[model samples]
Target: MTLTTALALGQTALKLGLICSLTVLALFLSYSMLNVCDLSTDGCFTLGAAVGAAVAICGHPFLSIFAAMLAGACSGFVTAFLQTKLGVESLLAGIIVNTGLYSINIAVMGGSSLLNMNKTTTVFSMMKEALSSTPFAAQTELIIGLIAVICVVAFLVFFLKTRLGLAIRATGNNADMVKSSSINPVFTTIVGLCIANSFTALSGCLLAQSQKSVDINIGQGMVTIALASLLIGGTVMGRGGILKRAVGMVLGAVIFRLVYTIALRFNMPAFMLKLVSSIIVVLAISGPYLKSQWPQIRRRLTHKKGGI
Candidate 1:
C-alpha cells in the first residue's frame, strides 16, 4: 500500500481502537478485577448509544454523555440486583438483562432501530468546530478519544486503590473472606458493575457520536471483543501494577483493531468479520495456555521418539 493509504488505514484503526478500548477498560474492571462476566455489556452499550444519541438530538450534546452513563449504571444495577438480591447466577443474570435491554433500547430510540445524527451537534462535531482553525483539526476524534481513555484509565488507577476498591477486589478474589471481614460482597458487586457498565456505556456513546449515527446492532458481539482484548492485554502485560496493566489493555485494543483493519483491507467479506473476531478471541484465550504446555508436549514427543 502507498504511504498515504497506509496512514489512512492506521488512523482509522487508531480512532476505533481508542474508542473501543473504553469497553476493554470496562471489562478490565468487571472481568479482571471484579471477576464477573457481564454479558449485558452488548445491550448496555447499545443503551448508551441510544440514550446519548437521543439526548444529543434533543440539543443537549454534553448532557448526552452523562445521560448515557446513568442509563448504563441503571442497567448494571439491575443485573447486579438479579445476581445479588434475586438469587440469579451471574451469567444468567447478565443474559436475562441483555435480553430485556433489546426492547428498552428500541424504546429509547423511539421504536426505531436506527438513529441518524448527521444534523446533530454531537460532542465530536462541537470539538471539531472548536479546533477548526488549528492544525489539530483533523485529529478531533483522536483527541476526544484519547481524552476519554486517559480519564477512565486515571479513574480506574485511583479508584482501584481506595478502600472500597480494595474491598471490591477482595470480593472478586474471595467473597467469603470479604464477608468474614464484614465487607458486604453484594454492595461491592453492585458498585463494581455500576462503574464498569458506565464505562461501557461511555464507550458506546462516544463511538456513536464519532460515527454520527447509532444502529441497534452497533454493540452486537461487543462482549466477545472486550473479552478478547482483555485476554490479550493480560497476556502481554502478565502481572503488573494497575496503571501498567491498563496501558496494556489500550495497546491490546489498538493491536486488535489494526489486525481487523488489515482484514478489511484484504477485501474480506463483511459477513466474515464476526468469524475473524471469534478466531482472534480463540487465539487470545488459548495462546498462553498453549505456550505453557509446549515444553511438556516436546518432552513427550522426544520420549516417544527414543522408544521408537
Candidate 2:
C-alpha cells in the first residue's frame, strides 16, 4: 500500500479500536479487578445504542450519552441484585439480565430493531462542525475516542487507589475477609458492576453516534471480543499497575481491529468474519499457553530423534 493508504487504514483502525477499547476496559474493571465475569455485556451495549440513538434522534444529542449510561447502570443494578440478593450465580444472573434487556432495548427503540439516524444530529456531527475550520478537522472521531479513553484510564488509575477502591479490590480477593472487616462485598460488587456497565454503555453510545445508526445486533458477540482483547492485553502488559494495564487493553483493542480491518480488505465474506473473530479469540486465549509448552515439545522431539 501507498503511504497515504497505509495511514488511512491505520487511522480507521485506531478510531474503531479506541472506541471498542472502552468495552475492553470495562472488562478489565469487572473481570480482572472485581473478579466478576459479567456476561450481560452484549445486551447492555445494545441497550446503550438503542437508547442513545432514540434520544439523539429526538434532538438532544448530548443527553443521549448520559441517558444511555444511566440505562446501563440500571442494567448492572439488576444483574447485581440477582446475584447478591436472589442467590443467583453471577454468570446466570448476567444471562438473565441480558435476555431481558433484549425486550427492553426493543422498547427503547420504539419497538423497532433498527434505528436510522441518517439525518439526525449526533455528537460526532457536532464535533465535526466544531472542528470544521481546524487543521485537525479530519480527526474528529479519533479525538473524541482518545479523549474518552484517556478520561476513563485516568479515572481507573485514581479510582483503583482510593480507600473504597482498595476495599472493592479486597472484596474481590476475599469476600469472607471483607465481611469480617465489616466491608460489604455486596455493595462493592454492585458499585463495581454498575461502573463497568456504564463504561460499556458509553462505548455503545459513542459507536452509535459515530456510525449514525443503531442496529439491534450492534453489540452481538461483543463479550467474546472484549474477553479476547482483555486476554491479549494481560499477556502484553503482564503484572503492571492500573495505568500500564489500561494502556495494554487499548493496544490490544487496536491490534484486534487492525486484524479485522485487514480481513475485510482481503474481500473476506461477511459470514466468515465471525469465524475470523473466533479464530482471533482462540489465538489470543491460547497463544501464551502454547508458548509456555514449546520448550517441552521441542525437548520431546529431540529425544525421539536421538532414540531413532
Candidate 3:
C-alpha cells in the first residue's frame, strides 16, 4: 500500500483499538466485582439496546440509556436472589435469568427480534450534533468511548477504596474470612453483582446508541467476550492494586479487540473467532500457574549447573 493509504489504515486501526479497549474495561469491572459468571450478559446486552432504542425512538435518548441500566440491574438482582436465597447454583441462576431476559428483550423491541434506530434520536446523534461543526465527527465515537472508559476506571478505583468496596473485595477473596468478621458475604455479593450488571447494561446502551439499532442476538456470547477482555488485561498487566487491576482490565479489552480486528483484517474464517477467544482466556487464566511452575525448572537447572 502507498504511504498515505498505510497511514489511513493505521489510524482506523487505532480508533478501533480504543473502542474495543474501553468496552473490555467496562466488562472487567462487571466480572471482578460480581463473582458472577453471567451468561445473562448476552441477553441483557440486547435488552439494553432494546430499551435504549425504544426510548430513543420516542425522543428521549438519555432516558433510554438509564432505562437500560435499570433493566440490567434488575436482572442481576434476580440472579443474586436466586443464588443466595433460593440456594441455586451461580451458573444455574445466571442461566435462568438469561433465559428470561431473552424474551423480555424481544418484548422491549415490540415483539420483534430487532429494532432499527437509523435516523433516530440516539445518544450518538446528540453528540454528533453538539460537535457538528468540528472535523472530529468521524472520530467522535472513539473519543467518547475513551472518555467513558476513563470515567469508569476512575469510578471503580474510587469505589474499591471505600469501606464497603473493600468489604466486597474481601468477600470475593474469602467468604469464610468475611463471615468470621461478622460481615454478610451474601450482601456484598448481591451488591457487587448489581453494580456489575449495571455496568454491562450501560455498555449495551452505549453500543445501541452508537450503532443506532438493536438486534435480538446482538449480545450473543457477550459474557465470553467480557471474560476474554478481563483475562487478557489481567495477564498482561499483572493484577496488583485495585486501580492497576481495573486499568489492566480495560487495556486487556482493547488488546482483545485488536486481536479480533487483525484476524478479521486477515480474512480469517468467522468460526475461528470463538476458538481464538477461548485460547486467549485459557492462556490468561493459566498464566499464574505457568509462572509458579517456572521456579521448579529454574531449581533443576541450578542443581545441574552446580554439579557440572
Candidate 4:
C-alpha cells in the first residue's frame, strides 16, 4: 500500500479505537472491577447510539451526549434492580435487559432500524466547525476522541480512589465482607453498573456521531469486543494501579482495532470478521493459562524424549 493509503487506514483505525475504547473502559469497570458480567452492554450501546442520533437529528447536538448517557443510566438501573431487588442473577439480569432493549431501541428510532444523519450537526461537526480555521481542522474527530478518553480515564483514576468508589470495588471483591463492614453492597453494585453503562452509552453515542449514522445492529456483539479488549488490557498490564490499567485498556483497544483494520486491508471476507474477534477473545483469555502450563508441557516432552 502507498504511504497515504496506510496513513488513512491508520487514522481511521485510531479514531475508531479511541471511540470504542470507551466501551472497553466501561467493561474495565463493570467486568474487571465490579465483577459484573453485564451482558446488556450491546443493547445499551445501541440504545445510546439511537438516543444520541435522534437528539442530534432534532438539532440538539450537545444535548445528545447527556441524553444518551441518561438512557444508559436507565438501562443500568433496570439491570441492577433485577439483580439486586428482584433476586435475579447478575448475568441473567443483563441478558433480560438486553433482550428487552431491542424493542426500546427501535421505538426510540421512530420504529426504524436505521437513522441517517449525514447533514445533522453532531458534536463532532460542531467541533469541526469551531476548528475550521485552525491547524487541527482535519484532526477534529481525533481531538474529541482523545479528550473524551483522557477525561474518562482521569475520572476513573480519581473516582476509584474515593470512598464510594472503594466501596464499589470492595463490593466487587467480597459482598459479604462489605456487608459486615456496614457497607451497602446493593447500593454499590447499582452505582457501579450505572456508571459503567453510562460509559458504554457514551461510546455508542460518540461512535454514531463519528460515523454520521446509527443502525439497530450498530452495537451487535459489542459486548464481545469490549470484553476481549478488556481482557487483552488486563493481560498486557497484568497487575497495576488504576491509571496504568486504564491506559492499558486504551492501548488494548487501539491494538485490536489496528489488527482489525489490517485484516480488512487483506480483503478478508466480512463474514469472517466475527470469527477473528472470537479468536482474539479466546487468545486473550487463554494466553496466561497457556503460559503457565508451558513449563509443565516442556517437562513432559523431555521425559518422553529420554524414554525414547
TM-score for all predictions? 0.95, 0.92, 0.87, 0.94
Once fitted onto the true fold, the runs of candidate 3 whose alpha carbons sit more than 4 angstroms away are: 1-27, 286-308
lDDT of 3 by residue, 220-279 (tens): 777777788888777778848978887787777767766676676678886686778878
The residue-by-residue lDDT of candidate 4 on 49-99, one tens digit each, is 999999999999999999999999899999999999999988999999999
lDDT (0-100) at residue 296 of candidate 4? 91
lDDT of each: 0.93, 0.90, 0.75, 0.92
After best superposition, candidate 2 residue 220: deviation in angstroms? Answer: 0.2
TM-score ranking, best first: 1, 4, 2, 3
After superposing all C-alphas onto the true structure, candidate 4 shows an RMSD in angstroms of 1.9
> Cα RMSD to native, each candidate?
1.7, 2.3, 3.6, 1.9
- Residue lDDT tens for model 2, 23-137: 9999998888889999999999998899999999999999999999999989988999899999999999999999999999999999998999989998889999999999988
**Candidate 3 vs candidate 4: which has greater lDDT?**
4
Per model, state how many residue pairs clash.
0, 0, 1, 0
Instruction: TM-score for candidate 1, please give it.
Output: 0.95
**Mind giving the per-residue lDDT tens digits that candidate 1 earns over 1-308?**
99999999999889999999999999999898999999999999999999999999999999999999999999999999999999999999999999999999999999999999999999899999999999999999999999999999999999999999999999898877987898988999999999999999999999999999999999999999888777777778889899999999998888878888988899987677567778888987788789999989999999999942
Candidate 2 local lDDT, residue 192: 90
